[model samples]
Target chain A: MARTAGSDGERTEAAIREAAVDLIARHGYEAVSMRQLAARVGVQAAALYRYFPTKEDLLFTLMREHMEALLGAWSEARPATTDATTRLATFVANHIAFHIERRSQTHISNMELRSLSPERLTFILRLRTSYEKELRAILRDGAEASVFDLDDIGLTAMAVIQMITGVIVWFRPDERLSVEGVTQTYLSMTMRLVGATTNRETQHVHAGTRLRA
Target chain B: MARTAGSDGERTEAAIREAAVDLIARHGYEAVSMRQLAARVGVQAAALYRYFPTKEDLLFTLMREHMEALLGAWSEARPATTDATTRLATFVANHIAFHIERRSQTHISNMELRSLSPERLTFILRLRTSYEKELRAILRDGAEASVFDLDDIGLTAMAVIQMITGVIVWFRPDERLSVEGVTQTYLSMTMRLVGATTNRETQHVHAGTRLRA
Candidate 1:
C-alpha cells in the first residue's frame, strides 16, 4: 500500500513538472498562477502546495532540471578521444538533440530567467557558465593543438551555443529535413566557423562540390 | 497652442512605449498590466488607453515598430556594392548595433510573440520573413558567384541570423570588449562560417597567427 502511494506521488510530481513547463512556456512565469497549474494537474491547490510551496520554486526547479539534463546529456555524449574536432562535433550534436527533444522546457529555461530571484538566478547562471566552460575548454584545446583556428575562445563559445540553441526556435521534424540532416549541416558550419582543418571534407560533402585545395 | 498639445501627446505616447518595454522585459508580457504600465509612466489608465485601446494592441505596436526599425536600419546600412561578403558584414554589424541599443525591446519582441493575436502574429512573422529574405538573397548571390561556399542557403541564412542576433543576449558596453571589437570578431566568424576566401585575412588578424594556406 505504501509503495503504491509513493509511486502515485512520484507520477503526480512528474505530471506537474510537465504541465508547468508547458503553461509557463505559453504564458510567462509571472502570469501563470499556482491555481491554474494545480487545475491543469488535476490536483487540489493544497496538494500542489505540498509539492511546491511557491511558484518561483516551480520555475527554478524546471530551469535547474533543464540545465542538469543538458549537462548530463553532454557527459554521456562526451567522446573519450582527446581529439578536439571530434569533441566539438559531439558537443554540438548532443546540445541540438537534447534541446530539440525538450523545446518547451528549453523555452522556459531561456525566457524565464528574469523571474528567478537574485540568488536563484545566480545558481542558474553558474550552471550555465559551467556548461559553457566545457565548450570553451574544447575550443581552447583545439586552438592550442593547431587543429581549430579561433579568435576569442569566450566569444566563439557563446556564438556556437546561441546558434545551436536557436535550432529549437525553428526546427520541426518535417519531411524536408531530419534532425540528423540539420545537425550535420550545423556541424559543418560550426567546423568552418572554428576554421577546423577537417571542415573542407565536411563542407565538400554538404556543398556537393570539389574544394579548391 | 494646438502644436504644443500635439507635441505633448506625442511625448506622452513615447514615454508609455518606453515604460512598456522596460516593464514587459522585466516581467513577461502576460504578467504586465496596463494599470501598472500607466503608473510607471505617471499617467492614468484612461490616458494610456487613449493611445493603445487594448493591451494586445500595445504589444503589437511595440513589436511592429521593433521590426520596422530593424528593417529601416538594415536598409540604410545596406551597402550599394554587390559584393556578398561586404553585404553580409554590413548586415551583421547593423543587426548587432541595432539590437544592442534596444536590448529591452529586443527581449520583449522575442519573448512576447506568444501574446499577440493570431492575425497580429502573422503580421509580425511576415515582417520577420521579409527581413530574413534579404539575408537569403545575399547568401544566394554569394553562393552563385562562388564568393561564399555554402551547404544550404536557407540553413546558412538562419544560422547566421541567429548567431548575430544573439549578440544582445550577453554583450554589454564593457571595458573588456567594445561594440566595434565584438562586431569585428563576429564578422570574422560569420565570414568563416560561410567559407569565404577573405576569412583567411580576417582570421589572421584576429588569431594573430599565420594560416597554412
Candidate 2:
C-alpha cells in the first residue's frame, strides 16, 4: 500500500511540474503562482507542497529534467561512423524535433533560466557550455580537414544552437511546412553556412510558397 | 517658456528609458522595477509615472523604440545594389552590427515579451513577423538566383534570426571576441547559411586573430 502511494505521489508531482512548465512557457515565470499551477493540475494548493517545497524548486526540477533530456538525445544520436557534418546534422534535427514537440518546456527552460539562483544557473550554463564544446570539437576537426568554410567554430556552434532553438519561437504544428521539411531546410542552410559542397540541386520556383521565391 | 519646459521633460523621460534599457539588459527584466528605474535616473518613482503609466508601459515603450531602431538600421544600410549576394551579405553584416550595439535592448525585449498582454504581445509579434518577412523575401530571391539552397524560406529565415538573436543569450562586451570579430564570424556563418558564394573562399586564420577553430 505504501509503495503504491509513493508511486502515485511521484506521478502527482510530475503532473504538477508539467502544468507549471506549460503555464510558465505560455506566460512568463513571474506571471505564474502556486495557486494557478495547482488549479491547472486539479490539485489543492496545499497538496502541491508535499512534492515541491516552493515554486522555485518546482521550476528548478523542470529545468533539470529538460537539460538531461537534451544531453541524452545528443548522446544517443551520436554514432562512431558519424562524421562531423552528419553528427551536427543529426544533433540539429533531433533538437528541432524535440523543441517542436515539447516547445512549452523548452520555452520555459530558455526564458526563465535567469530566475534560478546563481549557483544553479552556473551549473546549467556548464551543461550548456559542455554541449557547445563537444560540437566545437567536431567543428574544429571539420575546419582542419577543410570540410567546412566557417570562420569561427565557436560562433558557428552558437548560431547552430540559436537557429535550431528558434523553432520554439514560431513553429506551428498545423503549418504546411512539416517537421521533416523544416529540419531539411535548416540542414541545408547549416551545411551551406559551414561551407559543405551541397551541389545537389532542386528546381527553383518564383513567388510560389513563402519558402521559395 | 512652457515649450522649453516640455522639451526638458521629454529629455528626462528619454534618459530614464535609456537607463532602464541598459539595466534590464545587464540583468533580466524581472529584476527591474519602477523604483529601481527611477533611482537609476536620479528621480523618484512618482516622478517617473509622468512619462510611463506603469512598469510594463515603460518596458513596452522601450521595446517599441528598439524595434523601430532595428528596422531603421536595416533600411538605412540596405544597399541599392540589386545583386542578391551583396544585399544578403550587407544585411547579415548590418544585422550583426545592430545585435552587437543594442545587445541589451534586444535581450530584455525578448525575455519580457511574454509577460505583456495579448494586445501588446500581438503588436510585438507583428514586429517580429515583419522582420522575418524581410529575410524570407531576401532568401527567396537568393534561392531563385541559385545563390542559396533551401527547401523552406520561412525555416531558413527563422534560422538566421535565431542565430543572430541567440548572440544576446551569451554575448558579453567584456569577452575577448570584439564586436568586429563577432561580426565577421556571424557574417561568415550567415553568408554561408544564405548560400552566398562570396564568403566561401575566405580561409581560416586569415586577417589577424585566428578565429578559434
In candidate 2, residue A154 scores what lDDT? 81
Poorest 10 consecutive residues of model 2 chain B by lDDT? B204-213
State which candidate has the highest lDDT: 1
What is the Cα-based lDDT of residue B99 in candidate 2?
A: 75
Over B139-197, each residue of candidate 1 has an lDDT whose tens digit, in order, gives 99999999999999999999998998899889887899987788888889999899887
Per-residue accuracy of model 1 over A141-182 as CA lDDT, tens digit each: 999999998989999999999999999988897999988788
Pairs in steric clash, model 1: none
How much lDDT does each candidate structure score? 0.86, 0.72
The estimated TM-scores of all candidates read 0.92, 0.81
Quality of candidate 1's docking, in CAPRI categories?
medium
Lowest-lDDT window of 10 residues in candidate 1 chain A?
A204-213
- RMSD (Å) per prediction: 5.8, 6.5
- In angstroms, give how far residue A50 of model 2 lies from its true place: 3.6
Compared with the true structure, what per-residue lDDT tens digits does model 2 show for residues A64-105?
888888888778766464366665566666677767878788
- Quote the lDDT for A175 in model 2: 68
